[model samples]
Target: MRNDRQPDRPPLTTGAGWHRRRRGLAPWLLIGLYVVIGLAPLAITWLRGHPRQGLAHDLSSGLVMVGFAMMLMQFLLSGRFRDITGRVGADITILFHQLIAWTILAFVLLHPFLYAVPGLWPDPAQAVATLRGMFGSDALRSGGIAWWLLILLVPMAMWRDRLPIRYEIWRLSHGLGAAVIALAGLHHTLTVGTYSADPWLAGFWVVLAGLAVASLVHVYVLKPLRQFRHPYRLVSNREVADRIWEIQVEAERRPAINFAAGQFIWLNLGHSPFRLVEHPFSLSSTPADRPRLAVTVRESGDFTNRIGEIPVGTRAYVDGPYGTFTLARRRASGLAFFAGGVGLGPIIGLLRELVQEQYRGPVHLLYGNRVETQILYRDELEAMGKTLDFRLQLILSEPPEGWRGPAGELTPEVIDACLDGRFPKDWLYFVCGPVPMMESVEATLLARGVPARRIVSERFKYS
Candidate 1:
């Protein structure tokens, strides 16, 4: 690693907005809002002052409203809202969306069960009769529809990969099913809910449902129309590694999206953005690369398999420069990166940014792959070591004969060996890889006394 250090020209802390401490308030604020709205129905119900409907019955109604509120709120947490997602990361928002789905499921399943709770005493037969009577009622038909749809909807989303369905097909079914569920649930609430008779409570449900519909319109209609007006042209797409393609696109017009390195976009190519056809990909070119945006993707998934076939000059729609995994908000004396396989894309882009900025601090990278052929931009990374005080350690879990460098999985020992000895615990770290590997590395960092706030990462897929 060479270090002909020059006077500091670009400060890492220049964009104070990215400061983790500054942005920390957003997640709490969002969580507070979620709690308030989720409980708003219960609050209104209590205030409306209904006669005693028994504790179990009142509890069941409360659960139904909160669950429905959460369902509607799901539209806002769909990773498409920048104002919310900017402070609360896209990954966190999406994961929360998935998590809250299960909670909603619990509430829906328990609502009817709780209604029959009083009869489940000395004789179990009474509970069964209570449930049968409730199910037989014509007024509860909409509730039944929403309940059944929800039962199918949540599991479908959770095990989507295991089921033999295309992503687009699953997505279409998901959206349609959710809409029906919301509408039916709204109908049930407004028509049969004990508290629904109160005008304020009914109006609250209407407002939430309308917002839910507006969110759908914003994503499927409004945003796409905006993208259509400001499209990008595919300038080049070529193979960069074994089954890995690097795509570069230039703004069709004059304005290109400005983003920090390591940020990503939901890329819709050739296909109209109105269709649920886009995929999330990290931007692999430096922010300095301007109107020309680039992404490196592996040959996996339905759409990526044909990445090589996309001809130049094809139109593209980009939905973001999202994610908060960059130096823009962080302050550190040195930097460390851990990337696995295709994870090298954003890490390489960050390195490029550092080189472009002529960063003087020491930088270290640990990139792991199963074989040498899986490595992307081998020569380029080596060349980067010459420009900045950069050290790169290539860890191969399955290396070929005569391999000289460290070769194995990224264990604690391997990490310790690559640390350059002088790097301190406070140096900012970035990790990108398969979920298991990323988790292992993150745990290792935390165990080694790295502050949680000092480690930055982004995940598009969550279990």
Candidate 2:
């Protein structure tokens, strides 16, 4: 039998829950709107009564127009707008951005080639000669430039990690190159496109292109100006575990940025926001500790390795309160958390919130590390167990002698043991860790009768 005790937090049927429901639905609304916009050019071309240039030429023009619309919308998707990513989560947003890029690229690549198909065109040689003329003509220079630039841009982005350039340099070049592509693509469309000669369609392209440029300016200019106004100062930086460092920042004058328990921010230390020196990190502190925020970072990348050397009182900027990995927008009777290595950062913030809210439901935490020394905040977790109806299970892949706790990876059997035959379907499970660990835990939960909706997970890296 279940305890059936109510938690101290508001019920899902309340006003707060309604607000969350609306927020969750907003993403789908935006997506539907985007699809409609992307397909609008086709409808306008039909209404304009443009003469059909056979099936191949018509299809080629349609593909290019739709592809250009999608390419323009890509700027908005990657603009770091909270309204866009707040409900869908940043990981999903970025993944969609990457996947959709390939689709648009395919359309662009096939646009000119489709007309060259021998059976589709009445005169194949004429089609080939037309293509050569278009490519060779100085009047169509913008189109040629856009075509080649896109060919270079997509591959560069896809293989960014394999490149020798620094991440910052690559990021800057990506933005600049994208701007050039958009401008050149716009010029080509207005000059060469048959349907774009229509006033309505021409106006549509101009509006979309203008919006795309505005998005860039917002990200690179306006947002940074806002961040400069409300700066933060580094208060403390300490090595917590093996290579993990706990960083704390305090608001200098303005109030601290309020955020949900499990959200993250792009932290820029000792650098202007325009420098592209920031990195995303999950918050490890709850809102209950307002005006002061903390993030736990592991020494992996170049910037993170020198985290210990950052001087206190250094100026910092944060652009965030992003990601939908928090309980504020979710509802459940009980809660379960699974963390691996530094993935504990957001989980710990959530646990603190649960404790602060006086949540009286069953809670379980299954944390895994490679060794005993790598275990973080062990004493604090133990202390939390005493304050709430919490059970903490620590698992180490390699344990020292005389160790009595669970050993080895968090396999299905180990997870079953951790649950101790208590499987609450109503409980919401949060899993954060390395990609493999998260996948395993999600699969095990689903296999054990947990619904997919009940299992929520967050990935540290999108790629």
Candidate 3:
């Protein structure tokens, strides 16, 4: 991996206000642009006396799938949409990505059936025989087999948890599967000659291919090469709790990157972000502390469990500043954070910001863990609780004997108890936790007169 990291740039700390401001104008702008471009294409067809396939169901399905694929590619490359829209949150993003992939799979299966099953179609056995006969010479025939292999491999990678597979191996398989899909689709388009037979279809293919190539360069080559130039070295690492560690990293050169609190960056230890094993982690430190970044992790998976094994002075590549949940533009009189287990990573970042800004209003923290041992940053939270205008409530699901703090999950009752009238109804709430805990907390908040607009939550997905 070459040193390809870019020099220090302005931090992308603007919050939802930026997105909201754009949102209002975006729809009208998009509508106007759509009318212009869309109508122009239709008008061209009319002027040329060509038949237009207006909005056929099959064509709509195909377009939707392609549009989603384009969005995925855009996200995997730009990292801009993810920052502006929670669409790219760790949990939400993965779910939608899987949904889109499965939807495409459905289109893949249905397109042929709808077109061929009724009439003007070869029988199954005859079609198979014909396919086999033409395999070597026909690109579409070869690609048909390739498509099946892609369909097989992608699903397997997605459900790899059910199999005896590691994340690294699954990631590699997923990438290869995508490559097979792209090549096969390209071949099929060139050979089948349905839409591809048209000059306009050729133009569309060229654009998609160009975008795909650009994304590939951004992910695999350009980004990794830049990381080589701005290598961040681990300066210190310490165990924060049982099976948890806090790592401090600093740049070795003048152009050290500064990361915004609550924003996440993809970390590459021995390999670059392009590597199959790279993972995203939120920066647990504030931007005021320049030239260094801190990330806290629990031993939840292979990569995290091995964090303790990473030697001091090891080089790392950071590929982000992505995420919408930040303290930059939030307009709340008071702030509340609910964290479950290791989900305290972003909460800690928020706390640091509050402390730095000398926020005098109420700030409440409700953190839950299985045991006292699993509670990360316990001492720091306690100290901050005493020093700032903040309240801290620690809950242990399974407390040891003689333990007197709150016990059990962060249920509605637990959240209510933690609040204890310290904050008002209009207080801003941020929750980060495992899926179940977050869902429960968010529901509880909404039930307790906290408006949906006031509650913010983040869900972390381990992939």
Candidate 2: misplaced stretches above 4 Å? 1-25, 118-125
Candidate 2 clash pair list:
none
* Residue 295 C-alpha lDDT in model 3: 82
**C-alpha-based local distance difference test score of model 2:** 0.85
Give Cα distance to truth, residue 358, candidate 3, Å.
0.4
- In terms of lDDT, the poorest run of 10 residues in model 1 is 1-10
Model 1, runs deviating above 4 Å: 1-25, 121-126, 420-423
Candidate 1 clash pair list: 18-329
Q: Candidate 1 lDDT (Cα, whole model)?
A: 0.85
How many residue pairs of model 3 clash at the backbone?
10
Candidate 1 scores a C-alpha RMSD against the true structure in Å of 3.8
Show the colliding residue pairs in model 3. Answer: 2-228, 3-228, 3-229, 4-225, 4-226, 4-227, 4-228, 4-229, 5-226, 5-227
How many pairs collide in each candidate, listed in order? 1, 0, 10
Name the 10 consecutive residues with the lowest summed lDDT in model 2.
Answer: 13-22
